[model samples]
Target: MEIMQSLTDGIMLGGIYGVISIGLSLVFGVLGVVNFAQAQFLMLGMYVSWTLWKLLGIDPILGIPLTGAVVFIIGYLIEKTLIQRILKAPPVAQIFLTVGLMIFLENAVLLIYGSSFQSVVVSYQSLGFHIGSLFISAPYLMAFTAAVIVCAGLWIFLSRSWFGKAIRATSQDSDAAVLCGINVKQVYALAFSIGVALTAIGGAVILPYMTVSPSVGGQFSILMFTVVVLGGLGNVAGALVGGLVVGIIQSLSTMVFPVQLQNLILFIVFIGILAFKPEGLLKEK
Candidate 1:
């Protein structure tokens, strides 16, 4: 029963984890850039949601669209102005640029929002339901539901929409996409925008269960990378699977390991995966 309970909690947490990591995967897929600053965009989304809740009395979950929109615009602009320039640069240059962006974003938020931690107070924050002996948390359920909806919407948009096809084509081969009459530059900007927006929505949904601080993105940076790498860096569907696996490992480990050692366990798994299956668990042949 206890193990079952942990599995349920892990699934819920994993859904949200998938949502957060998808953006990083998308950016790398389409742009071929390892965006070290992607998690900072998650932090930015949290701040946007927090601002809306503090000033307008909007619940963070309810403000997901607004959070996504705000971050989407910011992402679009950043990609156009900065990332576009480095699209064809050497890998080291791209890495340094993104790392610098990460530092700038973190310090910028610290300057603007200060060092205080913030969180939302929603009606269902502490509510939960029980199915026999397994209990489900309200915030976790809501966040997981939202994550599912977002993932489904993204899949439809990617597989059905014309622009989505263009994005996929660009990812497969940007030069070929251009020869096929697709505007590769526009696709890059839009893909980056959509990627970060999805992550921002993830941040919004989890506000009920998480506190926001300037350094919060740092907490999830390594975790996000592990999820994406575990699933395959550019594989979107793999990210969801990886998230579930990681979430389950995290939850079950807590039963036998100390809280401080939970991440240590995850790190071990991450290292093992990298050493044995660098192509990721879901890599295609």
Candidate 2:
């Protein structure tokens, strides 16, 4: 029973982690920018949702569209203002830009929101249900459901939409996309915006299960990176696979290993994967 419980908890946790990784993976696969500020974007998302709820009493789920829209503008402006200039530069230069952006965004948020921990403070967030011998928290269950829906939606959009084809074209061959009368620049911005929107939605989904702090995104970001790499670089579906595997690994590790030590399972698996199958479990598109 205890083992089963840990597996369930891990799946729940991994689902939350999966949502964050999807955004990071998308941006990296398409634009090749690591976007180290992904965590900060996540923090900003949590802060926005919290403020909206506190001031106007808006439901967090209902505020999903509003959060996505706000972050969408911010992300698009970021690419237009700075990232676009250094797009042709070396990958290391791009890394520095993202690092600086991460610092600026995190410090700015800390200055404004402080280092305190915040939660949505909803009643049902702590509640759960029993399905057979398994118990599941409402927040975790909801996070899992939302994660699945968002991932599914992303797949459908990428596979079915015309804009998705344009985006795919840009990702595959930007110069070709430009020569073919497609606005590759616009595709870049649009792709990035949709990517960040996922992070915003991730923040909202995990609010009930985790505390939102100015630096919370930092912690989540690294784990998301590990998952992204484990799933293979540039593969969106791989992010889902990697996220669930890492989640289950960490959760189940608690049975024999200390709780804090569970995090190592991700990196260990990551290293093993790199050592064996460098392309990851799935080939990156």
Give me the candidate number with maximum lDDT: 1
TM-score of each: 0.98, 0.95
Assess each prediction's global lDDT (C-alpha) against the native: 0.92, 0.82
Model 2, 190-248: lDDT tens digits are 88888888888888877766788877876776588778888887788888888888898
Clashing pairs in 1: none
Q: Pairs clashing in candidate 2?
A: none
The C-alpha stretches of model 1 lying farther than 4 A from their native spots are none
- For candidate 1, lDDT tens digit of each residue in 1-285? 999999998999899999999999999999999999989989999999999999999988889889999999999999999999999999999999999999999999999999999998989999999999899899999999999999999999999999999999999989999999999999999999999998889889888899999999988888888999999998989988999888899999999999799789888988998999999999833
Point to the candidate with the largest TM-score.
1
Residue 258 of candidate 1: its Cα lDDT?
A: 92
